[model samples]
Target chain A: MTQVIVTVMPKQGVLDPQGQAVAGALGQLGFDGVGEVRIGKRIELSIAGDDPAGQARAMCEQLLANALIEDYTVEVGA
Target chain B: MSTTVAVLRFPGTLDHDSAVRAVEGLGATAVEAWHADAALPAGTDAVLLPGGFSYGDHLRCGAIASRAPIMGAVRRHAEAGGRVVGICNGFQVLCEAGLLPGALRRNSTLSFVCRQMELEVADDETPWTPGLETGAVISIPIKNNEGAWYGDAGTARVVLRYRDNLLGSTDAVAGVANAAGNVMGLMPHPEEACDALLGSTDGQIVLAGLIA
Candidate 1:
């Protein structure tokens, strides 16, 4: 069994309000040098297959991430 | 023959009833189509994807519902130049389904906005806005958590513009149509505003376009 992990993030230049709010909170807490914060989601799937990474990529392309506003990376292991 | 409009009902759709009511009020027959169904009702002249948190808004606002079984038929319908209108969450689904241009993202303010807003009819040539005049202002209510629209529409027509840039949409776009002009998606609840009792009858001016 291979574990595929997909990380999806708001594409650069897209407005990520939730990430900005978190960065604002960090700034208020005196965490200096926080340049930019963009939030995203991670999806993990357990697959029993020879090409789990390829399957995960196909899933990302089809439904897991929207190409219009988001970019995703898939990694396989374990 | 009276036009028949198919109002798609996804599992979590909240505004299907209002859409049906608005369609019936426009003197059109309203048929309810299910998300899991593989086809729309026969003789459907138009398709309406009403607002709601479909699939519990999982993955993204409309990500899951966009691939619902009935969407294949909707896509075919749009390809044949059938009129399709998506309101609020429906707009998100349209964008996700690639039937419309641009993507609706989380509101820039990161808040669920629910308010009556004025929209300027930027273009009145699409099937969804034939009853409106270019530059006319209409009152519609917008309610959603992820209603901010992103991306350049390129050749698609910008049919509606927010009068006050309420949700940080690019160029204050409230509604838009595909390049072919048969499909439209907007971030307002026109169905909810279809009656004078609901504080506005202006929505009828929009929905009435579906009947023909």
Candidate 2:
């Protein structure tokens, strides 16, 4: 079984209210030197395949992430 | 022959009945369609996807519902020039389905907004807004947590604009039509504003374009 991790982040220039809220809260909590903070999601998948990373990319294109508003990265683990 | 409008009902849809009634009140025959069904009813002239938390909004609002089997028919119908309108959550589904341009993001306020808002008829060329004159302003209720429309409308026609930009949508866009002008996705609840008792008959003006 191959394990894959997919990380999806809001595309640059897109408004991310949730991420902004988190950044604001961090500032309130006394965190310093934090530049623009953006938030995203991660998904882990276990599949029985030799090309799990390719499969994960296909999944991101089809359903895991919206290309218009998000960018995704895939990582494979043995 | 009276126009036949199909109102689609996905699990968790909250406004299918209201959409159906509004369509019927506008002199169109409204039929209920199911999400799992692969085809719309025979002789359907237009389609309406109503609002709600379909599939409990899992994996993102409208992401799962946009892939429902019935969407195949909806896409074919729209491609063939049939009128299609997606309201509120329905709008999100249309965006996700790639039938419409752009995506809806969380409102800038990070809170759900529910109230009547004013919209200007930005373009009267689409099949969904012919009843109103371009530049005309109408009041409709908008209720959603993720109602801020983003991305460039591109070649799509901007059909409506928010008078106040309450949701921080790009260009204050309230509604938009596909390049072909047959498919539309709007954030407001036009179905809920179809009667005076509902505080506005302005919605009827927008919906009447489906049959007119």
Candidate 3:
């Protein structure tokens, strides 16, 4: 059985104003080295059956995210 | 024919009553339901998730409120083919609940937009829009901080598009229906346009069409 985890968020070039606002605030905190920061969703799933990783990734693609504005990544179990 | 409907007014949700009157105006008995309340009052037939920022647009539009209690009942109702309409912010909530596909984000222009736009009646099979003639152009008010429609090119074509050879789209999607065709979410405010003084009462047809 392969467990999987996924993360979803907007693409960098698509313009994330909320993320930019946070980055601006961070600059005020004396964090000069931080170039950019974007916010996204981190989802973890615990699967007890076979090919859990595949199922999780499919979920991310089919419904868990919008591919145009957001990109997603899946992590398979060791 | 007495139909009871529940209009959900989540915190920050501003257009609950307009939805209520729209339903009542169509001859349905309507009432206001809270987000925290777990159970809907008896005799409730349909549920309308009205517009507004349920959690101050925090986390994401409709994100935090997706976990609201009455949503459970709404989910159950949808599973049984009960009618549900999400307008503007209400559309955001339905997407967050996984009742609809894709997500609404800030417009590509990155501005809080308030305007009247035309929507081609994409599908006429659904209960919420039986009054439309599948390709009819209807006018409604659309106002929101985040109302972008995003998804892949393929899903945009089949699932969202009204038809080929048409070009009035922000993302080729102003509204979307679930696979079951009972639940629908629209970024436009049909209620606002249901009165003659509002300039166009085209929305009343769709609202009244959902009578069941």
- The candidate that wins on lDDT is 2
TM per candidate comes to: 0.97, 0.97, 0.74
- Can you tell me the DockQ of model 2? 0.90
Q: By summed lDDT, which 10 consecutive residues of candidate 3 chain B come out lowest?
A: B158-167
> CAPRI verdict on model 1?
high
lDDT of 2 by residue, B36-155 (tens): 999999989999999999999888899999999999999999999888999999999999999999888899999999999999999877777665789989999999999999878656
Off by over 4 Å in 1: none
lDDT for each of the candidates? Answer: 0.90, 0.91, 0.75
Two-chain DockQ for each candidate model:
0.93, 0.90, 0.15
Q: What is the clash tally of candidate 1? A: 0
User: How would you class the docking of model 2?
Assistant: high
User: What is the C-alpha RMSD, rounded to one decimal, of candidate 1?
Assistant: 1.1
Model 3 per-residue lDDT tens digits across residues B1-212: 68888899888988887888778777888888888988877777888888888889775688777778889989998898888888888888888888888777776544677887777776677676664667777778788778775544344321223332122234568788787787888888888988888899877776764567
Q: Write the per-residue lDDT of candidate 1 for residues B4-107, one digit (tens) a residue.
A: 99999998999998898899998899999999999999889999999999999999998899999999999999999898999988999999999999999888
Winner of 2 and 3 under TM-score: 2
lDDT of 2 at A53: 91
Which 10-residue window in model 1 chain A sums to the lowest lDDT?
A47-56
